[model samples]
Target: MTGTTRYLPPGRLSRAINRVVAALTRRGLSLWGSRILSVAGRTTGIMRSTPVNVLAFDDEQYLVAARGNTQWVRNLRAVGRGKLAVGRREQWFTAVEVLDDTRLPVLRAYLRRWSWEVGAFFDGVTADASDDELRAAADKHPVFRIVPTSTPEDRG
Candidate 1:
C-alpha cells in the first residue's frame, strides 16, 4: 500500500488538459461524470484539487483512481474525507477504502465507462478482463465509496 502501488504522474500535456477540465467542471460542466475532487494535503494540510471520474453503481457513487494510490487517494486516506464539486455544486463526503475483494464491480464499471481516458494506467486491464484480473489490479488502484454528508462544503 505504501511503496507497491503504481502511480502515473501527469505530464505537462495532461496537467494542461486537467486544468481545462477542472475549470470547466468547476463551472458546472461535468464531462462524462467528471468532477473536481478537493482534499487536504496529507502533510501540509493545504487543499489540492484534481479532476476525477465518478462511478455510480448499485445506487452508490464511488471515486476510483485509475492511477494507483495517487496523491489524491493518499490525501483522502489521511483526511478520511473530501469534497466533489461540479459547477457551483459542492458535496462533502466521507471516503472508505474498498477492500480488494469488493472492488471488482466498481473497478470493472469504471473501466467500462472511462477506460479510454485512464485505461493505460491499469496496465492493460480493461473492463472486459476477468473478475480475478480486476481483483488483482485492485491492490494498485484504490476505490473509495463516497458517502455524502451534510457538511460545510455542501451547497445543496
Candidate 2:
C-alpha cells in the first residue's frame, strides 16, 4: 500500500490489454506501432526519434518511464526539450520531471481519470498509492510531462 507498491509497473493483465489495444489501433498504421512516440537527440542538441505507447495524456503527457535510465530519457533530460507525435498530430513541449511528493495525490487523481489505460496496466487492481510513495517512485522513474506550448494540433 506504500513505497514501491504504489509505483509498481503495469501488471500482466494490464500489460496484456495495452498490448491488444495497441495492436488493434496500430493495424495497418504506417508511422510507428505506438501512437505515442518519444524522440530524443543522439548527439548533444541533436534529435533522436523513438516511438512509445503513450500511457496517458493530461494537461501534461504521462509516460510510464518503465525502462528506467534508458537512453531516451537520458537524452530528453539532456536537451530539456523534445517532440511527442501522436497520430498525425505533433507538438513541441518542454520536458520537466515532477518530483514533488505532494504531487502524488494529483498524480493518482490524474491516473484515475485514465483508468482505462492506467487500470489495464495494473490488471484492474485497485490503483491506490499514497502521495509520498508515488512521489518517491516518480522521482526514481519520474513521469516526464511535455508541458504543452500551444493547443495540440486540431484533430478535427
> In terms of TM-score, which candidate is strongest?
1
Clashing pairs in 1: 27-87, 28-87
Q: How would you encode candidate 1's per-residue C-alpha lDDT over 1-156 as one tens digit per residue? A: 434568888889889999999889989999999999999899998899999999989899999887777899889988989889998898888988888577888999999899889988889999999988887788888889999999576512
- What digit string (tens of lDDT, one per residue) describes model 2 on residues 1-156? 112323344569756865665454445342322553445565855566554544444454555454345566766667666666644566677767655563465457545655554444433333386554555445444456656566444210
| Superposed model 2: Cα runs more than 4 Å off | 1-34, 42-46, 53-58, 106-126, 150-156
Per-prediction TM-score: 0.92, 0.54
lDDT score, residue 26, model 2? 43
For model 1, the local distance difference test gives 0.87
Tell me the spans in candidate 1 whose CA falls farther than 4 Å from its real position.
1-3, 152-156
How far does residue 66 in candidate 1 sit from its true spot (Å)? 0.8
RMSD of each: 2.5, 7.3
